[model samples]
Target: MQLIRSILAAPLLRSRIASIAQLRRTFSSSTSVSARAFKYVVSRRVKQKPAKKTNFWVKQHLKTGRRIKYPPYPYGDSNIFKRSNRGLFGGKFPMQGHSVSSELEKKNLRRWLPNANKTTLYSSVLKKRIRLHVVASVMKTIKKEGGLDNYLTKDKPARIKELGPRGWRLRYAVLLRLKEQEAKRLRGR
Candidate 1:
């Protein structure tokens, strides 16, 4: 009772007690802000790390050290492999650009299509004939690799890129056939 009497006697303590009671009432009913209440404030001038710049295409060009005339289609957008099933142009796509002949002449847009020919390629491993439309460059590569089997089985990045979907499927089939043949030979022995 004396402590309560002493608290009531002090003007500042009395006002503080009254404010706390009012604050409790306000909190029970609705949200309220008091002058004495502590608040968490976020600083606007807080330091942040800058985002790193990435020049992917520039890096690729620098690594190759050659300007690419034709770039492969984005495989992420759709199944590029399915589209390449028609004819394997070694991942080459038709390029369309404006061709300017003279300084005063208007730009003429033209589509340059690769020369694809239907050719028969023999795979010594699978012992079968494959007839498909292929570009001259692909044919030259197959010849250089010795045969279709070697061309398909080679794990080179350039060769894999040129293979496309049809070649990839053919490689799997050839591998399975080779495995079966090996098993048969072992059984005979």
Candidate 2:
């Protein structure tokens, strides 16, 4: 009777051990899965650097190496009273704190002023006031050449040589400008 009971107990003990082993395997797998998910969440929550804001004026100044000063007045200031002097001449004349001739010389204004109309001059002034160096340079070149037609017809090779390898780019831009101006004029009429 004792031997039979011992044999039965041994098989029962083996079965119990197998069940415990299965439980341990299941628990370990579940814990490992949870640990991996926790690690993923922690990685995702890590702080990132904020994006920097670029100022147009500063960028233009840097690119062109020009000293583009801000206007004396604030952005929202009323130009009604000040318009009499500044508006008539388009502020191209000398003022209390600003010298138009000096500004023009600094920006190489002679290249464009001969061909510029009131509209063109006004637009150029706006660009300069805003400190857009790239547009200002393009405007000056385009105006100096007296439109795309003149540039293309006058001397293709000579102009190209004078402008170096990138002359084609300037020609393309001038052509686009001409088309845009023509479209605008047609619309206005």
Candidate 3:
């Protein structure tokens, strides 16, 4: 019985060495493959070059009378190729500061008072305290003339209203005319 047990243990120990040798044959090689192997093995993974991004805005928006490539936009963007903008209410210019409530009257008003002295004009704006739009137009003109800061600064706000309402209305009118002139200027540009 002892001899049989010894014989069984010897076979088991021998199988353990054979198993280790089998593992070494399968996975234990640390030696790097020779560079010469690459000569025969063609690289299957061709370097996948990246696709380029397209810049198509200029071609898309060229000012031509051809059929449009995109849908119309409700808001006019300088870059977009679109038609008239849509609004819930009609007859109102989408641009601010122009009131179409009484277009003809407004046009006449522009003719009636074309110029108001800047000093007196700015003061009237402070007084009528009309809608902020009137003030904004005057400020816009002053800015265009490169003298808004000179005419009215935070420190001079009080002196503005002392100029009176008539003066302010006249200033507002002059601003409207100036804007019209500027519009013509831009159209020519």
Candidate 4:
């Protein structure tokens, strides 16, 4: 029984050595692989690659027009404006400041929230009226751009970057609608 156990243990030890030898040959002999990668392999530590930056939602929305979850704000991310989606503030978010009291000379933290009014915006491209909570700045910009449709469909980087998830979805919807109309018009002709 002792002899049999020794025989089994000898092969197991040899197999372990064989595996190590294979690993050394696989890594050390490959000039294409780096020494750091070989060290990671020997240590059994996996080197994770960095995540690629992508506009995944924009691509997917344009391709499939599928429902997308609200992603993080692209610019000036602040947790204070929790209800940013509830209103279009044009780039203005809630501001935090110290409010001084005259009587005690105490500096208190205060947040100045933008006033959002319920308003209706007409979209000529979509032929629809959208009721939304909008701030004065956003309303002014929309009017300046000629209408809500123009504002949403603008290809400027600043405009695209500042648009939150809700705005992005709305923009894509309007774009798809416009494309469909154009295709139909072309087909008729």
Candidate 5:
């Protein structure tokens, strides 16, 4: 019975020792592989080629000389480069500012203002002229009425009395449009 017990213990100890040795060998080999991989990565990054400088004249020459060939046109002798007589916004002038409300009033105000060169005047200049006039007039009216808060509380009749009939109408329209824009902004529109 003692001999059998010793034999069994010997085999178990040998197996345990063999497993420990295998584990150590595996761990050592994995660490070496990792070290080699890190070195390879570092060496590869260091050995990267420097970027070549491009000549501007050479680039320009290449661009100008290289014309892409297109298939021949089936239709004979059409002038593809001719400018069309059509204007933007279907021949009507485009509105200048971001404010979408009171467009008609803006257009009327623009027409009322005199232009230095009517034929050559741009829509932007016209819009700016109208905007300047409206802002100045409204500011004058506000100042005359004391303040904005006071102006708001006053009745329409009293406000009209402060500014003349035509002046009051224009100021009222401008202020109303401005208020609409502010309300739109507040509502996240």
Candidate 6:
């Protein structure tokens, strides 16, 4: 309250108030100069911070620093994994198999099941072909489901293993692509 009064009681504000009161007295000499404006100044002493927030403001502030507003790959909103992430932009590239071991695994099983190649799910014997299979399976699933917007990242497994080995493989491939897309979008912006 003391700080509030000091800011409002500045000489500039006091002179402005006095000038307004002088004008009011000139216009209506019958009215007291001590009235209306003095009460208004005391009541509105604190110039509260602006409450209007926009998407642009958030994006602008977040983008000002090296910080990336998007969540790190395979995790939640806050960067609790800051200790673990040493990479450029902090955990953007992802550790080996982290995406699969983390979130998005269950999403693959639930959304990609209809079109996924069950045989190539974990075929380490043919690594290249298996990678292709996962990407193809994801594309097929995306097309079958209409588009990528349907796969909500938040719907991933609370316990990752239930996504299964095949689901894990597929999830990693999609996670890579999504990371690439995000990088490109940020660069473009």
Candidate 4 has its poorest 10 consecutive residues by lDDT at: 54-63
Give me the displacement of residue 131 in model 5, in angstroms: 11
Candidate 1: which stretches are off by over 4 Å? 1-83, 102-104
**Colliding pairs, model 5:** none
Q: What would the per-residue lDDT of candidate 5 be over residues 1-189, giving only the tens digit for each residue?
A: 997778658977779878888888754544655355454444334677788753221122223575323233222222331111111011112233343346464422222221212121112211212211223444544468574434433555644343332233333444544565688799995
Q: Local distance difference test, per candidate?
A: 0.67, 0.40, 0.38, 0.71, 0.37, 0.40
TM-score per candidate, in order? 0.53, 0.22, 0.19, 0.56, 0.20, 0.22
Output the lDDT of residue 54, model 3.
Answer: 27
* Stretches > 4 Å off in candidate 2: 1-155
**lDDT string, candidate 1, 1-189, tens digits:** 998898799999889989999888743434555654566775578788798653221222323576422234223222533455655568776778988878778899998777688998777775667777888888888789788787778877766666775666666666656776898899999
lDDT of 2 by residue, 1-189 (tens): 998778658977879878888888754544655355454444346688798654333333423576444333222232433322212121122223322465455432232221213332322211222211123333555568674335432454544433322223333334445566688899999
What is the C-alpha lDDT profile of model 3 across 100-166, one tens digit per residue? Answer: 4454655222222212222322323222222122233445545664643233332243334422332
Better of 2 and 4 by lDDT: 4
Candidate No. with top lDDT: 4
Question: lDDT, candidate 5, residue 178?
Answer: 55
Q: How far does residue 141 in candidate 4 sit from its true spot (Å)?
A: 0.6
Q: What's the distance in Å from true for residue 110, model 4?
A: 1.1
The segments of candidate 3 whose C-alpha lies over 4 angstroms from its true place after superposition are: 1-156
Q: RMSD of model 1, in Å? A: 20.6
What TM-score does structure 3 among the candidates reach?
Answer: 0.19
Candidate 6 segments exceeding 4 Å error: 1-154, 158-162
Best by TM-score: 4
Residue 157, candidate 6: C-alpha displacement in angstroms: 2.0
